[model samples]
Target: MQGFLKVFGHPNPKNPIGYGIDSVFPQLIADAQCLHIVAGRGFACTILIATTSKGAIYFGRLLLGLSNGFLVTFSNIYVSEVAPAYLRGVLVALVSPWVSMGAILGAAIDNATKTRVDKSCYQLPTACLYIVPVLLSVGLFFVPESPRYLLFQRYEAKAKQSLVRVRGELSNQ
Candidate 1:
């Protein structure tokens, strides 16, 4: 598949830019996914905090669902792509467990806060929901692009650097 993409180009000779769609597409999708996740969650937070209209709240719920779907899909793709073969299965398997744990924790919070008469009962949980996206948005700055992604993009040096950033320097025997 990679070889096919590398070899093929648009049939038209007049085209200035052809081939390498595989490279650009993933990068574009990843950037868009990240942006969407952050913005969607931020919008959700606003909707939860300020909106009283049922329509707005419903729209926020829809956005949150879409954002959650994107998060899970992108996370699995990224984990599979970046993980070493030996650890890949284990790492992928752990995602669901973590998500379940989060659900349990969220339920506990909701139970604990349920008794409060004020808006804080629901607002507290909403605030908690905001934390993950905010932290993820900030943490993304320190995370290197997956080496496999860089390689797919034909960035050999960058791929090597990203690999080293993730895996540390390999010692020469």
Candidate 2:
């Protein structure tokens, strides 16, 4: 496994860096599962938006990157825990398609769909990268903040609200 992950942003033997980023993905996503998905999106979007701007995009992007990490880690586990027993499988199942769709979308947008006005292609799957996170975040708004998060946070009202919300949504014929 250790030998396998030496591929991400790996160092080019022909050029300078001693090693490469390698395929650290399995470890990368091991904890959060969605870490790669969200971070890739965040990173792509940050790169695109930052390139056009002049100053201090670095710190902002850094924060976004960190947020991407923390949020995805927190959320994936959060989702699994709060979901009802029967719905647990369904929730985890969602991770697969979302990750795939985001990657595909990023491929499409970054493929060459730059702004019509500028005619410049900033990145591959550019649209998809930016759009994926936004879409996921938006969908998140509809998702209940895990019962565990709320209960642990001691926001009783929210916990109850979450339960009622999911139940209502499910029971609606």
Candidate 3:
């Protein structure tokens, strides 16, 4: 399914809607975090409504997929660009392990709630999805944009500021 979606993931050469989305969003981290928050909320809502209807569950899955597509793509690019060269491979590799940890944590939460007779069973598990995005949104405020992005956009001063924030005093290097 993900492989099939990758086809659409590529920016259309003729329309370039995806390119515009990528370029126009000045704050990539914040925007990606926002996408996570919305996706989390959408998943929670979908699960809640899913108790009543099949259609709502399907719709929620669709929304979750869309938001996740954007979040993963943007976050990966942003992280790769922002990370220092020495740590770039380690940081990128960490993404998969973190995803695995999330899966484990989610399974633990589901296991704990599985015995409940009421709606709390699903609600509790679904609510756990909010934790990462909520924390990420707050953390992003402390993070600087990718220096490369700033440089590419021709904001040399801001790029330097971002580099200083990430690399800590370039010192004529």
Candidate 4:
């Protein structure tokens, strides 16, 4: 298993500088995930406003694609790693429904704006995209780091504290 992980780069390649900024700031991955989402929404909003400029819209869309790819991959990883063991499956399963809800909301917005002849048609829907990422970015600040990540970094006390925070009091359990 260790050999397979090494071959596949499961833990990622070692940096000569000792993990660089990540070592100094443990929340780098989470911050990056939030950044990608916020930036993606920014691109979407920009694309909507650039109705006359096909090139600008196309470039914005390309950036959106890159941001969304990173956002989805990192979000899933973050959720799975951070969730408590007993609730892991439930938390992971909720991801699909959460995504579906966003689609449903977007569709409803599109339906409402379908009759508009002005730029408001796409602009309203695009503007709505900002809500989720903004809320998510703010929400991330309240959550603790993944216990596994803390443990891997040899921060046992912090890992235990994280588990306690996520799982709640031992007496309740």
Candidate 5:
């Protein structure tokens, strides 16, 4: 639902970064990171639920929902824009497998920690979630903004740079 809403929403015109996916991608990634952090903290706080409330668990769910939504939507857009035409279909198809891989890993972690009676069971799984955001943040730093997005905004120089980063030299063809 959040993804559906974002599709129709206009980018902030006042943003110095300009508009469209170029502007929105970075923000979405950052929001995902923030949400991940919130979820992690919420999960960690669950340790205190004996004295506190079960509300922390719900808060984590809320953060996870928002985080996963943004990641799913923008990741599709980013992959579509960045992948070469011939490879685009295959690349997009891989997303499902990757998602499954994450689920599998999470399940493995849960199975491994399920026997614990203390906070470690949940805490260990929650701590593992932090790895996704950390790796994503680092990875995003090395990735160029989508050339197609830059072109749409008339940033020709930046678009060229982005293209070169992704595709190597621009052929005369």
Candidate 6:
């Protein structure tokens, strides 16, 4: 526990961002356990589509769960930050519909591809998860770390650079 906190905890041990990020450990653990149960979700799905019936569905569940988990945190952070206080309630209320819309779109694409439970279809949905890392990298490039975290850590240069990068100008500080 102590070892875990040291790695996941905040620099000052008091900030909300640190606290919230650290809390994600429990969630990440759940995600990892889910991955193990089904085994290489995407890989398994691909195998199932190509080979066996029993193997694919178990892994397909895992792949969907993993994909949803990856995007959920970002949606929380982004919508919370950018939504104005007056309309925050309304904005958040739209989350469910947006998720449904995404699912529909994914289903549309998959259906269009006409992939069967065979290898091709199995690879497609799970393979889509691989792009999450790329999407995350693109998103990360535009997000600045909280000033408090930077100040607590004494990483002024890195913090400032991040600020400039995200805000697109040093004057943003």
Worst 10 residues of 1 by lDDT: 9-18
lDDT of 2 by residue, 10-64 (tens): 5457524344342234324443444445665576466655475545356546655
Which one wins on TM-score?
A: 1
Each model's TM-score? Answer: 0.80, 0.48, 0.74, 0.76, 0.72, 0.47
Query: Which has the greatest lDDT?
Result: 1
TM-score of 1: 0.80
**Candidate 4, lDDT over the whole model:** 0.73
Where in model 1 is the C-alpha error above 4 Å?
1-29, 171-173
TM-score for predicted model 6 compared with the true structure: 0.47
Per-residue CA lDDT of candidate 5, range 63-83, in tens?
566667767877888889988
Of models 3 and 4, which has the larger TM-score?
A: 4
> Can you rank all candidates by lDDT, best first?
1, 4, 5, 3, 2, 6
lDDT of 1: 0.80
Q: Write the per-residue lDDT of candidate 4 for residues 1-173, one digit (tens) a residue.
A: 34533453335446432332334354675567677677676767677566668787787777767776767777788788877678778987887898789899999999999999998898888788778777877887787787888887667888888878977755643
Better of 1 and 6 by TM-score: 1
lDDT of 6 by residue, 7-62 (tens): 76546455443342443455456445434433444454455456556655666566
Q: Candidate 1 vs candidate 6: which has greater lDDT?
A: 1
Candidate achieving higher lDDT, 2 or 4: 4
Alpha-carbon deviation at 109 in model 5, angstroms: 1.0
- Model 2 CA deviation exceeding 4 Å by range: 1-47, 52-67, 113-119, 123-128, 136-145, 153-158, 169-173
Better of 1 and 5 by TM-score: 1
Off by over 4 Å in 4: 1-23, 170-173
**Residues 1-173 of candidate 3: C-alpha lDDT, one tens digit per residue:** 23432453344454323332333445654566665656565664656545667777776667666766666667788788878889988987887898789889989999999999988898788766667667766776787777897786557898999999988888884
Worst 10 residues of 6 by lDDT: 15-24
Q: Model 1 over residues 1-173: C-alpha lDDT tens digits?
A: 54554565333333344444535566666777787898898888889877778898899889888888888888888788777789999999998998999899999999999999998898888888888898888887777788887986678988988877876884664
Q: In terms of TM-score, how similar is model 3 to the real structure? A: 0.74
